[model samples]
Target: MPRTGDEFITVLKKAHIEWGNHRHTSTRGVVYGEGYLQIPRSEARTIGIFNSNSSNTHIFNCNSTDGFLVNASIKASGSSTANDVFAKQFQGNGNLRLIGDWFRHVNAQVGDQVKISWTSPTDIEITKL
Candidate 1:
């Protein structure tokens, strides 16, 4: 099922994901984490984590300019004491990039899914599943 921003936030909160603010006032963007959270984008490029250790995988649906659509998935596995999963999608004509440590538990699994819809600059929409 598709999830709204609030719904997605609730799910992340329940899952105990980290949260942070991505401030890009200057040329380079800065991401600071207060707890656990996920960020959504309305552009098209690359998205997903590189080093994750969760037992879950996330799927994403993305639409790009020129009517391009792509689905990206990230997966990780380990002993029952440690697992991680990260996934993302790219949409529109922009670029999407995911970074950071997804999971760090001794015996736990993690996963995520992100969906994006591009309609313009201020009309982009994202749904989490």
Candidate 2:
């Protein structure tokens, strides 16, 4: 029999597979833990990390006008607050960049595991697992 959505999510969660927007991936990468997170472009696009239509070649720098701002409430074991996560696409590697102090607030570090998913269409929740 076919499994329900919640059941599928449960399975994904157990396996540490990334899932959202009817998409899932098992790709894993190293965490910087330096107040920023870089997500694989393909996975980020699949999970709707930012508006898909947003330019993926935009670089973030002084006098920047290429990236977009995401207002999200990041919830970790230690904190829960609305924060601004600047979303940008690396011009060279095309990775998805989420820059903010949220990582510091959550006390993320190298080798830490995190699960990012959409709590709603407009909300993303990141949990350190």
Q: Indicate which candidate wins on lDDT.
A: 2
Worst 10 residues of 1 by lDDT: 99-108
Candidate 2's TM-score: 0.36
TM value for model 1: 0.22
Give per-model TM-scores: 0.22, 0.36
Q: Kindly report the root-mean-square deviation of model 2 from the true structure over all alpha carbons.
A: 14.8
User: What does candidate 2's lDDT look like per residue over 1-129, in tens digits?
Assistant: 111111101111211221111223355543332133344444443443332234332222211112132443222111112331223221112322232234344444556665544434433444555
lDDT of 1 by residue, 58-93 (tens): 333333222322232212111222332332222112
Question: Global lDDT of each model?
Answer: 0.29, 0.30
Misplaced by over 4 Å in model 2 are 1-34, 50-100
Candidate with maximal TM-score: 2
